[model samples]
Target: MFDESVSKKIHVPLVLSMFIGLLTILINFFYSVEDIRSEVYSSQSKELRAAYVNGLREKKVIALTNVINLSSNYSIIESLKSQDRNVAIAGLQTLSRKFKEQTIYKNIKVHLHDANLRSFLRTWDVEKYGEELAGFRKTLRDVKKNKKAIATIELGRAGLLVRGIAPIENDGVYLGSVEFMQGFNSIVKNLRKNREYETAFLMKEDYLSVATALSSSPKIKEFVLAVKEKNVDKDFLNSLKGVEIEDTKNFQISDEYFLVSEPIKDFSNVIVGYALIGEKTSMVETVIAKAKSSLLKQVYIIFFIDIIILIYLIIIVRKKIIRPIVDMEKMAQELSL
Candidate 1:
C-alpha cells in the first residue's frame, strides 16, 4: 500500500511537470520563429524598395532631361507662344522630324500647353484630347505656376506612367509647359528579368494594373497570370488593404507569400496606387523548418535530462525516506509484541 501511494504521487507529478515543460518550450520556439521571420522580411523589403525606387527615379530623370532640352529651345518656345495653331502645329512637326532619330525622343509622348492651360499640341494622332485638360494636371499646374520642372509617378488612362513637366521659357518668359510621359512597362520588365522576383502594380479594389514574374519557374508564371483583376482572392485583398509603404506582411493567394508594398505617389503626394514585390513562401518555409528542428532538438535534450533527474529523485526518496520509515515501524511492532 505504501509503495502504491508513493508511485501514484511521484508518477502523477512527474508526468504533469513534463507536459508543462514541453508546452512552454513549444510556445517559446514559435515566438522565436515569428520574430526571426519578421526581421528577415523587413530587412529584405527595404532593399527591394530602394532598388525599385532608384530605377524609377532614373527613368523620371531621363524623361525630365529630354523635356527640358526640347522645350527650352528658342524655336520651340516661340512656336508655343505664337498664339497660332498652324504655326504651333508646323513647328512641332518640324521639331519631331528633326529629332526623330535621337534615342532620347524615341517612345516618348509629348504634350504642349499654353499659359492659360490650353492645349497647343500632342504627339498623338488625335485632333485633340479636348480642352477638358487631361494627364497629370497637378504636375502641369506646378510647372506653370512655379515656372520650374516637376516629375512624378502617376496613374494615367493607359497605365502607370512616369511623367516630367518643364516650363517652356525663353528669356525668363514662361509661354507654357511641355509635359512628357512614358509608360512604366520597361521598369517592370527590367525588374522581372533582372531580379528573379515577382512584381505587381495593384490599383484600388485589388485590380492588377500590371504584373510579371521571373520566367525561371513555371509555377510563378501561373501565379502571376492568375493574379489578374477578377481573380484576386478575398483574403489576399483584405490583407493587402492594410499594407503601407515600407511595411512588410505575409499574404496568401495560391500559396503563402511575403509581400512588401510601397505606395506610388503623385506630384501632390497622393497615394495613387501600390507596387507589390513578393517571394514565394517555399524559401522561408525551409528556413523556419530548420529553426524549429534545432529548437526541438534542444527541447529533447533538456527533457531527457529532466526525466533522468525525476527518476533519480523518486528512487532516492523511496529508499532513504519511505522505505526507512516502513522498516522502523515493523521493528517497533515486533518489540512491543
Candidate 2:
C-alpha cells in the first residue's frame, strides 16, 4: 500500500517535471535550428551571386580577347573594307566550327558590321545580310564611337547576347566592326552543368521590345521575359505572380526551391533584367541533417539527466514520507488495542 502511495504521488509528478524540461529543450533547440538554416541559406546565396558575377566577367574577357583577335586579322579587315561577304565568311568559317565544339562557347555568332552599323555578314546566319542595325545595335555603335574594344550583355534581334565588338580599320579609316557573340542559353546551361545550380536570365519587356527577336520568348511575369533554357521550372515561375523580378534576394519559390538574384545590365549600363541563381532546397536539407543529429544528441543527454533526477525523487519519497506514515499508523493501532 505504501509503495502504491509513493508511485501515485511522487513518481507521477516527477515524470511530469522531467517531461516539462524535455519539452522546453525541444522547443528551444528547434528555434536554434531554424536560425542556423536561415544563416546558411543567406550565406550560400551570397556565394552563388559571386559565382554568377565571376562567370560573366570571365566570359567578357574571353569575348574581348577573341574579338580583338578577329579585328587584328588582315584578311578579315580587308574583307570588311571591300564589303566582300564571301571572303569574310571563308576567313572565319573554320574557327566558327571549332567554337561550336567547345564545352561552353557553342552557338557563337560572328557578325561583320559596317561603320553605318549595317549587318555585312553573319556566320550564324549567312544569307541574311544588309539589315540596318542603326536602330537596335547599341553595343556595335558604342564600339564604333569609342573606337575601342567593348564586351557586354545586350539584347539583339536573336535575343540576349553576350557580345564583344572591335572596330575594323585600314589606313586610319574605320571600315566596320567584327563581333563574337554568344547566346544567354549557352551561358546559363553551362552554369548548370558546371556549378550544379539552376539559373534564368529575366529580360524586361520594355528592353526586349527594341529588338525583334527571331523566336517567341515566354513571359515569366507581367512584363518579364525568360529564355527557354531556364533551369527553374514552371512551378517556380508560377510562384512569381506578385513577387518583383528584381527583388529575388533570398527568395524561396517553394518548400524545395530557393533562389537569389542579381540585376543584369547592358552595354549602356542600363538595368534590363535579372540573373536568378538557385539550387534545390535539398542543398539546405543536407546541412540541416547534420544539425538535426546534433540536436538529437543534446536531447538524449538532457533526457538521461531527467531520468536520473526522477529516480532520486522516487527514492526520497519512499524513505522520507511512505515509511514514516506506515510506522505511525502501526503505533496508533497498537495503543488503541
Q: Which candidate is the best by lDDT?
A: 2
RMSD of 1: 9.3
Predicted candidate 1 versus true structure: per-residue lDDT over 1-337, tens digit per residue = 7657766776678778877987887788778778866665565566567767877888889888878887866656777767655665676666677667765454457777887777777767438833645343667777777887877765555445788888887667778888777765555556657764456655443223332222221121112222233333334444444445233343332345556666777666876566676555576566667766776788789878877887787788778877887787778889999
Q: Residues 251-290, candidate 2, lDDT per residue (tens digit)?
A: 5545556677788888788887887777777876786778
* Deviating ranges (above 4 Å) for candidate 2: 1-31, 101-106, 229-243, 295-337
Please state the error at residue 231 of candidate 1 in Å: 16
Query: Can you give the lDDT of residue 22 in candidate 1?
Result: 72
lDDT of each: 0.64, 0.76
C-alpha displacement of 104 in model 1, angstroms? 8.2
> Candidate 1: lDDT over CA atoms?
0.64
TM-score of each: 0.57, 0.73
